[model samples]
Target: MMTALLLHGYASGIYSSRRIARAAVERADFMMIVAGDAPDFRTISEFRRRHLKALADLFVQVLKLAEKAGLVKLGHVALDGTKIKANASKHKAMSYD
Candidate 1:
Protein backbone atom coordinates (compact mmCIF):
# COMPACT_ATOMS: atom_id res chain seq x y z
CA MET A 1 0.00 0.00 0.00
CA MET A 2 2.77 2.39 0.93
CA THR A 3 4.72 1.49 -2.20
CA ALA A 4 1.63 2.04 -4.32
CA LEU A 5 0.96 5.44 -2.85
CA LEU A 6 4.55 6.60 -3.23
CA LEU A 7 4.84 5.36 -6.78
CA HIS A 8 1.55 6.99 -7.68
CA GLY A 9 2.62 10.27 -6.13
CA TYR A 10 6.19 10.24 -7.40
CA ALA A 11 6.28 8.24 -10.61
CA SER A 12 2.85 7.33 -11.91
CA GLY A 13 2.04 10.90 -12.94
CA ILE A 14 -1.28 10.63 -11.23
CA TYR A 15 -2.79 12.84 -8.56
CA SER A 16 -6.33 11.60 -8.48
CA SER A 17 -6.78 8.95 -5.83
CA ARG A 18 -9.02 6.95 -8.12
CA ARG A 19 -6.39 6.95 -10.82
CA ILE A 20 -3.75 5.90 -8.36
CA ALA A 21 -5.85 2.96 -7.37
CA ARG A 22 -6.40 2.12 -10.98
CA ALA A 23 -2.73 2.34 -11.77
CA ALA A 24 -1.85 0.03 -8.96
CA VAL A 25 -4.32 -2.48 -10.24
CA GLU A 26 -3.26 -2.26 -13.86
CA ARG A 27 0.48 -1.73 -13.49
CA ALA A 28 1.87 -4.19 -11.04
CA ASP A 29 5.52 -3.27 -11.46
CA PHE A 30 4.68 0.40 -11.42
CA MET A 31 2.95 0.26 -8.05
CA MET A 32 3.20 -3.24 -6.80
CA ILE A 33 1.62 -3.99 -3.43
CA VAL A 34 2.97 -6.92 -1.47
CA ALA A 35 -0.52 -7.88 -0.40
CA GLY A 36 -1.55 -8.76 -3.97
CA ASP A 37 -4.81 -6.79 -3.74
CA ALA A 38 -5.02 -3.22 -4.91
CA PRO A 39 -6.71 -0.76 -2.59
CA ASP A 40 -9.41 1.71 -3.48
CA PHE A 41 -9.14 5.49 -3.59
CA ARG A 42 -10.59 6.00 -0.13
CA THR A 43 -8.15 3.55 1.40
CA ILE A 44 -5.22 5.14 -0.37
CA SER A 45 -6.34 8.60 0.78
CA GLU A 46 -6.75 7.48 4.37
CA PHE A 47 -3.35 5.83 4.35
CA ARG A 48 -1.68 8.97 3.03
CA ARG A 49 -3.55 11.24 5.43
CA ARG A 50 -2.71 9.03 8.37
CA HIS A 51 0.94 8.58 7.47
CA LEU A 52 1.90 11.84 5.81
CA LYS A 53 4.28 12.88 8.54
CA ALA A 54 5.89 9.51 8.74
CA LEU A 55 6.38 9.49 5.01
CA ALA A 56 8.06 12.88 5.07
CA ASP A 57 10.32 11.81 7.87
CA LEU A 58 11.21 8.62 6.07
CA PHE A 59 12.09 10.57 2.96
CA VAL A 60 14.37 12.83 4.95
CA GLN A 61 16.08 9.86 6.46
CA VAL A 62 16.65 8.37 3.04
CA LEU A 63 18.19 11.59 1.81
CA LYS A 64 20.49 11.79 4.81
CA LEU A 65 21.60 8.22 4.36
CA ALA A 66 22.21 8.81 0.68
CA GLU A 67 24.30 11.84 1.46
CA LYS A 68 26.34 9.87 3.93
CA ALA A 69 26.94 7.23 1.29
CA GLY A 70 27.84 9.89 -1.30
CA LEU A 71 24.85 8.98 -3.39
CA VAL A 72 23.52 12.53 -3.10
CA LYS A 73 25.18 15.82 -2.44
CA LEU A 74 24.61 17.44 0.90
CA GLY A 75 22.46 20.56 0.96
CA HIS A 76 21.19 19.75 -2.52
CA VAL A 77 17.62 18.93 -3.43
CA ALA A 78 16.01 17.57 -6.54
CA LEU A 79 12.54 18.50 -7.64
CA ASP A 80 10.53 16.33 -10.01
CA GLY A 81 7.27 17.15 -11.67
CA THR A 82 4.72 15.02 -13.48
CA LYS A 83 1.62 15.96 -15.37
CA ILE A 84 -1.46 14.98 -13.43
CA LYS A 85 -4.77 14.07 -15.00
CA ALA A 86 -7.66 15.73 -13.22
CA ASN A 87 -10.82 13.72 -13.02
CA ALA A 88 -13.00 15.82 -10.77
CA SER A 89 -15.34 18.44 -12.09
CA LYS A 90 -15.87 21.90 -10.61
CA HIS A 91 -19.00 20.63 -8.95
CA LYS A 92 -17.11 17.85 -7.15
CA ALA A 93 -14.19 19.90 -5.82
CA MET A 94 -14.43 22.86 -3.45
CA SER A 95 -12.07 25.13 -1.57
CA TYR A 96 -12.22 25.77 2.13
CA ASP A 97 -10.50 29.11 2.09
Candidate 2:
Protein backbone atom coordinates (compact mmCIF):
# COMPACT_ATOMS: atom_id res chain seq x y z
CA MET A 1 0.00 0.00 0.00
CA MET A 2 2.79 2.42 0.86
CA THR A 3 4.67 1.61 -2.32
CA ALA A 4 1.53 1.98 -4.42
CA LEU A 5 0.71 5.38 -2.96
CA LEU A 6 4.28 6.58 -3.36
CA LEU A 7 4.31 5.55 -6.99
CA HIS A 8 0.93 7.27 -7.42
CA GLY A 9 2.39 10.59 -6.20
CA TYR A 10 4.98 10.34 -8.97
CA ALA A 11 2.62 8.96 -11.62
CA SER A 12 -0.84 10.14 -12.68
CA GLY A 13 -3.27 7.38 -11.68
CA ILE A 14 -3.56 3.91 -10.19
CA TYR A 15 -3.34 2.23 -13.59
CA SER A 16 0.15 3.67 -14.13
CA SER A 17 1.08 3.18 -10.48
CA ARG A 18 0.04 -0.47 -10.63
CA ARG A 19 2.82 -1.17 -13.13
CA ILE A 20 5.42 0.16 -10.74
CA ALA A 21 3.78 -1.67 -7.83
CA ARG A 22 3.97 -4.94 -9.75
CA ALA A 23 7.69 -4.49 -10.35
CA ALA A 24 8.35 -3.79 -6.69
CA VAL A 25 6.19 -6.72 -5.65
CA GLU A 26 8.19 -9.06 -7.85
CA ARG A 27 11.40 -8.26 -6.04
CA ALA A 28 11.63 -9.56 -2.47
CA ASP A 29 14.23 -6.91 -1.74
CA PHE A 30 11.93 -4.43 0.08
CA MET A 31 10.47 -4.76 3.56
CA MET A 32 7.17 -3.23 2.52
CA ILE A 33 4.04 -5.35 2.16
CA VAL A 34 1.88 -5.00 -0.96
CA ALA A 35 -1.82 -5.29 -0.34
CA GLY A 36 -5.14 -4.86 -2.15
CA ASP A 37 -6.03 -3.78 -5.68
CA ALA A 38 -5.34 -0.30 -6.97
CA PRO A 39 -8.17 2.20 -6.96
CA ASP A 40 -10.72 2.19 -9.75
CA PHE A 41 -9.93 4.01 -13.00
CA ARG A 42 -13.29 5.69 -13.59
CA THR A 43 -13.05 9.38 -14.51
CA ILE A 44 -16.55 10.47 -13.56
CA SER A 45 -16.89 13.68 -11.55
CA GLU A 46 -19.15 12.00 -9.02
CA PHE A 47 -16.56 9.30 -8.44
CA ARG A 48 -13.95 11.97 -7.75
CA ARG A 49 -16.21 13.73 -5.28
CA ARG A 50 -17.02 10.48 -3.52
CA HIS A 51 -13.42 9.37 -3.29
CA LEU A 52 -11.85 12.74 -2.49
CA LYS A 53 -11.74 12.18 1.27
CA ALA A 54 -10.39 8.66 0.88
CA LEU A 55 -7.70 9.87 -1.48
CA ALA A 56 -6.67 12.61 0.93
CA ASP A 57 -6.38 10.06 3.75
CA LEU A 58 -4.31 7.78 1.58
CA PHE A 59 -1.97 10.68 0.73
CA VAL A 60 -1.40 11.38 4.41
CA GLN A 61 -0.61 7.72 5.03
CA VAL A 62 1.88 7.75 2.16
CA LEU A 63 3.64 10.84 3.53
CA LYS A 64 3.88 9.29 6.98
CA LEU A 65 5.48 6.18 5.51
CA ALA A 66 7.96 8.32 3.60
CA GLU A 67 8.89 10.21 6.76
CA LYS A 68 9.36 6.95 8.66
CA ALA A 69 11.59 5.61 5.88
CA GLY A 70 13.69 8.83 5.91
CA LEU A 71 12.81 9.51 2.29
CA VAL A 72 10.97 12.79 2.74
CA LYS A 73 13.18 15.10 0.76
CA LEU A 74 12.41 17.40 -2.12
CA GLY A 75 14.08 16.55 -5.42
CA HIS A 76 13.79 17.42 -9.08
CA VAL A 77 10.18 17.31 -10.18
CA ALA A 78 8.51 17.21 -13.59
CA LEU A 79 5.05 18.32 -14.58
CA ASP A 80 3.56 17.21 -17.86
CA GLY A 81 0.56 18.76 -19.54
CA THR A 82 -2.06 16.25 -20.58
CA LYS A 83 -2.75 16.18 -24.29
CA ILE A 84 -6.51 15.75 -24.47
CA LYS A 85 -7.88 15.18 -27.94
CA ALA A 86 -11.57 15.66 -27.38
CA ASN A 87 -14.17 14.14 -29.63
CA ALA A 88 -16.66 16.64 -28.24
CA SER A 89 -17.27 19.98 -29.93
CA LYS A 90 -14.57 22.54 -29.13
CA HIS A 91 -17.30 25.09 -28.46
CA LYS A 92 -18.19 23.07 -25.37
CA ALA A 93 -14.88 24.14 -23.82
CA MET A 94 -14.88 27.73 -25.04
CA SER A 95 -15.53 29.76 -21.93
CA TYR A 96 -13.84 32.48 -19.90
CA ASP A 97 -11.31 31.02 -17.51
Listed per model in order, the count of residue pairs whose N, CA or C atoms clash below 3 Å is 0, 0
Q: What lDDT tens digits, residue by residue, belong to model 1 across residues 4-46? A: 4664466446777777777777776644553557777898788
Query: What is every candidate's alpha-carbon RMSD to the true fold?
Result: 13.6, 13.3
Cα lDDT of model 2 by residue, 1-97, tens digit: 5434444434444334444445344534321434433333232234445776786787677777887899886467999998987667677758667
Query: Can you tell me which runs of candidate 2 are displaced by over 4 Å?
Result: 1-45, 73-97
User: Model 2 — which ten-residue stretch has the worst lDDT?
Assistant: 36-45
What's the lDDT for residue 52 in model 1?
Answer: 85
Model 1, position 84, has a per-residue lDDT of 90
Full-model lDDT for every candidate: 0.71, 0.51
What pairs collide in candidate 1?
A: none
Q: What is candidate 1's local distance difference test score? A: 0.71
Off by over 4 Å in 1: 3-16, 74-97
| Residue 20 lDDT, candidate 1, scale 0-100 | 75
The CA root-mean-square deviation of candidate 2, after full C-alpha superposition on the true structure, stands at: 13.3
